[model samples]
Target: MRRRLSEYGLFFRECLRNFHATGAIVPSGRFLASALARFVGNGPAGGQQILEVGPGTGAVTRRIVAQMGPDDQLDLVEPNDRFVEQLRQQFETDPALQRVAERVRVLHCPVEQLAHGKVYDLIISGLPLNNFSVADVQGILAALTGLLKPGGTLSFFEYIAVRRARALLSGRAERARLRGIGRAIGAVLDQHEIRREWIWPNLPPAWVHHVRL
Candidate 1:
């Protein structure tokens, strides 16, 4: 209980310090994390590789780690140094994470800047697309897509009706930016979306979009 509260405090501080990168007001709710980690598993012959981007303080990371098979490996890519430190500490102390600590690694970098040839069977993202420019979101999405193996799935979430709500209060420039982001996201969902999960119990409600190549 104390640990969870502390994690939330850290997340909240990160939000105030860097809302654009930290994204949400708090860590993802359990339901939303579960939906995002739904694809984490061992394949027919075992040994599935998973990648999680923007795993702030390991909210969704816990769910993903809980779902990982014996032979599964997870790489967490986080841009925030404090979040990365917290994640490392969790693996060192948290009982559940300790179980698969050997199979997990935390990378201190953005997904866009991660330079590696490794591809994953499943990729879950906690990035806030609505906070970025259209080009930035498109680039980030493209990079995530490129990191997946053939037929691999990518699960990411967007807050429900966030753009609309913000657009109502934002200036014309902000509204146009929001619309551009919507169009960029819509294009991907229209073509590659495999499933959608609506999680209403989250902070402000959210939709997890699962897509494939």
Candidate 2:
């Protein structure tokens, strides 16, 4: 209980310090995590490789660990030092994560910087695409698609109505940036989006997009 509280505190602090990068004020809720990890347990039991980007404090990471197969491998990419350390400790000490500790690697870098040699069957992302510039979002999406296997699935979520709401209150520059993000996402969705699930239980209800490449 105490550990979870401390993790939330740290996450909140990071949000204040780096709103664009940290994204959320708190870690993902259980329903959101489950939706993001929907593909984790569906593959062939033995040789699946999964990658999780921006796993802040391991909220979704716990759900992924719960669903992971004995021989499955997981790679976590997080640029925040505090989050990276917290995730490493969670895998070392948390019961759910410890069960699959040997198969987990917490990389201290952005997902775009992840090596190219290894591709994954499932990629779950907690990145805040709406907070990034158009080019950055495009690069991130390209990197994610590149890391996925031919038939691999990528699951990610964005707060519902965020762009519309932001546009209502933001200045012209912010509105234009949001439109660019929409264009980038639309381009990807036009090509590969397979399903979109809505989770109304989240703080700011979100939509989970599942894309297959």
Candidate 3:
């Protein structure tokens, strides 16, 4: 309970400091985390390489750790210094995560800057796509798909009703930005969406998109 509350506090602070990057005011709910990590169990045999982008406070990170096999490897890309520190501590101190600590590497940089050519079997993104500009979203998406192996899976989420809600209150510029993001996301989904799940239990509700490349 205390740990959970502490995570929430950290999430709240980061959200305030980088709302566009942090995306959510709170850590992902268990239901949402489980849904996002669904592919972790269905991965191809032998072993799997996974990349998690924007892992704020290690909420989904913990869930992924729980689902990881002994041979699996996880690489976390988080630009926030505080969250990176917290994630390192989680692996160091959390009993459930300590066993797999050696399998995880926490990289403090944008996903786009990560070394290329190394492909992942699965990529789970916690980025708030809606908050970014169209060009940024496109570049990020390109980087994500680039990191994935052939037929690999990429999972990410966006809040439900966000576009409609923002459209109502946002000015012309903001509204146009949201629509541009939609088009960018749509282009990817139209081609590669294999599955999508709606999690109503999460704060403000959310939609998870599973794309294959």
Please, what is the TM-score per model?
A: 0.98, 0.97, 0.97
Q: On residues 114-160, what C-alpha lDDT tens digit does candidate 2 reach at each position?
A: 88699999999999999999999999999999999999999999999
Sequence-dependent TM-score of model 1: 0.98
Ten-residue stretch with the least lDDT total in model 2: 39-48
Once superposed on the true structure, which residue ranges of model 3 sit more than 4 Å away at CA?
A: none
Model 1, 1-213: lDDT tens per residue? 999999999999999999988788889999999999988884546788999999998999999988888999999999898999999999999898999999999999999998789999999999999999988999998899899999999999999999999999999999999999999999989999999999999998999999999
Q: Tell me which residue pairs clash in candidate 1.
A: none
lDDT of 2: 0.92
Clashing pairs in 3: none
What digit string (tens of lDDT, one per residue) describes model 3 on residues 31-85?
9999899999567777799999999898899899999987899999999999999
For candidate 3, the 10 contiguous residues with the lowest summed lDDT are 38-47
lDDT of every model, 2 decimals: 0.93, 0.92, 0.92
RMSD score of candidate 3 (Å) = 1.0
TM-score, candidate 2, is 0.97
Model 2, runs deviating above 4 Å? none
